[model samples]
Target: MDTHITGRTAADIADSVRSLLERGVLEPGDALPPVRTLADRLGVNRNTAVAAYRQLTQAGIAVSRGRAGTRIVDRAPVPQEGFAAGSVLRDVGTGNPDAALIPDPSRALADVVGRPVLYGEPVIDRELEQWALEWLGADLAPRDIRVTVTSGAVDAVERLLAQALTRDDAVALENPCFLSAIHTVRLGGYRAVPVPVDEQGMTPAGLRAALDDGVRAVVCTPRAQNPTGASLTAERAAELRAVLADHPYVLVIEDDHFSMLSHAPAQSLIGAHHRRWALVRSVSKFLGPDMCLAVTATDPYTADRLAMRLSPGTTWVSHLLQRLAFSLITDPEVREGITRAGAHYAERNDSFAARLRAYGLPCTPGDGLNVWLALPAPARAVAEQLMRRGWLPRTGEEFAVDGLPGSAHLRLTVHELDDTDAERLAADIAEAVRAVSRSGSGMIDR
Candidate 1:
């Protein structure tokens, strides 16, 4: 293992460490030299070494031990699934929307370019705000709701948490949560209190327990929750609202990431009378990830604080991108395309899940772009077997927030696959499960 660390600047040193990590040159539990020793070796001031260490800690790449020194964290880094470069295996693990379903922005771009915004201009595009409010208002009960635009859902969540909660404050997050949300909570230094989510979304008992634990904020996905593709039923949403009623002051954040694509209706957890709340609708699913625009409907107080952080000339989302998103959403042809795309995703996911069940592996197709397939064997073993069979799938452990061994499950994005590919994946999945079910390693009953 390469354990050497050398750089004149803090950022340089941090980048070097991250590169080594990505290349697997330095594994977890490896120790770095003392700051004084590293500073001398790198020919930099002692403060530079300290800053580099601090940067690494903030990024969750390394942990500091009081008298012992700094070392790579023993835990596996959060899993991020990117395109499998140079791999001939059929990839079913990429957590992404179907590329063909995304509406082309070329037509919308013509209408998006008229205005050039200047400093001190309105942070949000006027037309976009009006349209967003109209769409959100139909679902939300009458109230004084404020709106803020952010680059993306993760960006909005990070800013919202920073504005409302202090470091180490407890924030309730769904168990087997969205990967980005998990990263946001961890990187923000907020304590994550896991609330179990079933088919109907976050369980009432789980929310009650988290509230009892004194979580200052609650993050929920009202529809098409990532990984599991779970949506909140109206009854379950009401139950959660009742639980949250006593604690109205807690900041409730609802990430409706699949707003346009969800086959389900919006079952909100933020009651009309809730004090501080935000409902984020990211357009990435419909428009494309490159759009990077999300409209946030928030309570006045939270919006005000978020505005403080996103002040003009600093953190405001670009108006050009906002207008481009708005143009696409308002276009009739694009709306029709989005509607067709939603149905296509639902059909594909359901079809894939049905095939899995037919093969004797239990699986359910939920509201999102992915299907959650519960396996009889450990997800790791099954995934390994599938990889050997020329497929890549994500294990449920990647989405677990509690750091415990996860239930046996695989989160697969098979909605983009054709009938033959989907069937092949299902048959392979069943075979993999049977091959590993008796191995007796990391098996957890759902």
Candidate 2:
């Protein structure tokens, strides 16, 4: 009998598997012995082997496939938001704001210089905090809230989850979720319970299902959701809030990342009476990614816990950055420029969507910096064809939580593309879809 996975206790066996993984003895996708077989071999209860596999799954080291048994998960780095480094193709997949649209900080920076902020002082800049309070208070009105500053939306979410959840906790995320959110949940060892999103935003049925599954935290993008650009309608938001009202203790995080840039009106899923909720607005979208700052408004209890993690003399955001962000955002000229920028993004995306529709492809002018184009063929195959035609696009599969096959959508960032480039890219996508359909390599979902 092979004694490779020899251990009597669940933790012991899980540790042994990790050791084997570290030594490259058990490669990714390699199936482990059946629980019963392993238990018999190790002279332990079958439940012990099951528990071992559960531990590995929770740690993201392995995956359980029921009757097919468990296997080591491939830990390759997931794709993130940015330009593809060194790619020669006309990259339309990059989910970036227009450089021309970002407000100029040169004048703001010159005036932002102030006294050096010493340790043990307040982490948040007083001016920035006052501005953020009015800003966040406008939307999250009637509910008493406390504000906390973080490096960015992603940073705020990580800290929020860390304060509220532990390992193996379940977090409800949108099905075609934000890339950063997916990565954060996985890296934190939280099981992501996917909630399906429709044109109006997160479905009430999906939210209910996730809550029923015992998710401890729910992360939602109320407006301009990433990848799909699905904004929550007021009716949908009301429905979701009603669903969430029962679970008042569950931590709800609304990442309104596209606060200034979104063409859609703001809608929220956090109920007025909910006890634990947060609204995170980041300036990275309109102010440029270099400005790493996000203002978060949360219930007082969550705020207290988050403050401890972001205490003075530790991980507090830099006062200089806060001052600079404040100056730029509050400047009347900069605010006017930001409004124009938002309009620019909306117009470009709308034009591209119209171009795709002209080519017989279905696409909606969703709110965001990118257009979620639906194709008649598999997104991966079409993406490959587009690459050959001098274009780079992000397949919807890259954004899917479950990595389901036959994804027929591509997220294209065409706002920066000129009229000629936009038309050419749209024509190329139509051609690629036709070619892939003719090849019949995979079944098309749509």
Candidate 3:
């Protein structure tokens, strides 16, 4: 298939082919037609075709033989590790929510102890599942919602997609996707189609294109979109709903991973249509990630499919854990703690963004438990430099879909920084960005 690169560069044309192969559109050992035929088919010059082929060959994706024609070299290159071992920079790049902010599971778990469901017991805890449905249904309102709890939201999404898709089936996802989404798609052996996002969230054009390309599932972040805090606006969510109406049967999974941590009003893409869908709001961010629980709401049909996967041999989610989550959510003290944490994250991140701007680094701030900032150069070099300064920050590269590379950005857990620590760390990051840009070097300034 000729990748449509009508308005794209010659190299972009090549990249499209690479992207296609990465998505399994081009199978291993599959023969590509002669360069001339490809150029004619794609409306590109023969020289452009030659360059594109050479580019693919150098990427270890395709190989050339005198008369055998170019063939796909099966297999993917190992991904380079982006984060330094135990090098989480103190100032920024800690993807975790503030430890102090997590509702003390101690107090919440104090009340929970239930009789374990023994052999021959139903796989799901009926009361817990019913309560979970009520809690998860809080935002989206009544639909064909059914509750299916798994180890966590990641586990939930993985099982949900597996029940619906096959290996190499196209799964639409936001570009610069959540880390768990990337891992889930990879583990399931599914192809990810990148849908571009902006301040208002997933672009309509990108989504329409993905649908046209025959995607089987979509994984979207409604609010507190990781890496960038951009969320779906009310207008934008309505637009997506309108756009998705025609394709209701496509499984749409929305991950509200940072639920209740931001003051921003929730807007949903899944709310638009009544088709195969699941909206997962995990307690990881607002509640502690260690809770190991996620509230998943899916259509009745999809829930039935997931129930089979949750049956015996799985043993189901622990009754104790579910009761703990239920107790915590319903607790007045815990709810107050959540509100306090949301305010703390908002204020601290805003302050950090202010400091960055003071140093001439601009950023688009939004509602997340953390802040996203653009580095003067690629984020990796800046991150390495920070490590030498005794700080660890997460770069944008780690959060993108396989064929798409995230840009010069960093995600910082500003809420964890004290006032003095915040100022010093900001200065250190600024200096590091400048140093890497000047030397074009990977070594951090000692």
Candidate 4:
């Protein structure tokens, strides 16, 4: 392992350490040499070794003991799936929408121009905004509709929080919340109040609790919430609205990421009543992946405040891509494509969940792009076993909110599993639970 520690910089040192652990040269609890001695031996500054140590710590490949040196930590294995295109049965994780939902853009971009716009180019194309306005609907008018585009729903969330919050401010969010929303709040240096979300969107009790806590802002997903896919019901929405009515001026941000492709209609926290709110809807779901554009409708006053952070010199969204999105959404053929894709995703996910139930593995299959599964053991260990069987499953740990205990469940994207493979995965998951379900592993507490 020392033979590979030849470079004189921080990254080189980190790579050498990583390579050692990867090759099993340093097993768990084996201490690295003293920083000064390692620095001298590698012929580099002490800072380089320090930086390398930090990198390993972040990656969970190693841990430090202050004055003591570093040692390796156990890591779960990573699986390798083949890189094949045009297969809908291989995509997993929170961030991906169903591939079938993506608009076929080969024809749209085929004839489109390729010039990247220069400075002073319009931040938003006038024609595109007009089309987007119609797309969002006419009921959202009379109050104010300000359309601002961003990379995606997550991008819009970050910018909205940045403008509304100072570091360490409190923000309300859904519990077992979408990971991007949780991460965005934490990254902005804000404390998160996890309001519970049930069949009814944010519960009335949860809303009241959060408001009583004096949160600076609220991030909500009123429709087709990512992990659970439970769209807020009308009765629940009304109760939540009543709870929020007292704090009319708090910045209310709603992320309805499944804009056009959702099987159900959109619900809103920023609907007709609110005075200070933003309804952020992104096109990444129906449009092709990597297409980054979002339409934000806000109350006029809030729109002006948000605009201050979105002026020409700073963070305005792109214009050319906006036009391309406009061209696709307005076209009739692309609209049908989205409808077809939504049905396909629902059918596939429902089938997988039904099969899981048939196999005695209880789970929930709801409206979004994925399935939520409740396992009999810790999700992390089960996911590791799934990988060894050629399935790459994501655990719910990353998306758990502050108040919630880490789950024994996993959020599986059934889009990646075909009929045959779904059956096999279900069987493998059952075996994995039996193999790793050690009673005192702290899995229950986790």
Task: Tell me the tens digit of each residue's lDDT in model 1 across 13-47.
Answer: 99988888878888888898888888888888999
Clash totals for all candidate models: 0, 0, 4, 0
Q: Is candidate 2 or candidate 4 better by TM-score?
A: 2
lDDT of each: 0.86, 0.89, 0.78, 0.73
- What are the per-residue Cα lDDT tens digits for candidate 4 across 1-446? 35556568878777877777668777766777777878888888888888887777665566666676676653422222223345343445544665655777777775455677777676767887777666665535356577777777887788778777776567999877887777666555577898877755678788889899989798888777867787877677777777777788888998888767677766666546677788888887788558877888777776676777777445666665777787888789988888888888888888888888887888667777778787777888887777677766777766667634446877777675678888887788887776776533545532
Model 2, span 307-375: residue lDDT tens: 987764356888889999999898888888899999999999989989989999988977888888777
> Number of clashing pairs, model 3?
4
Judging by lDDT against the true structure, name the best candidate. 2
Question: Per-residue lDDT for 85 in model 1?
Answer: 68
Which ten-residue region of model 1 has the weakest summed lDDT?
1-10
Off by over 4 Å in 1: 1-76, 438-446
Best by TM-score: 2
lDDT of 4 at 278: 83
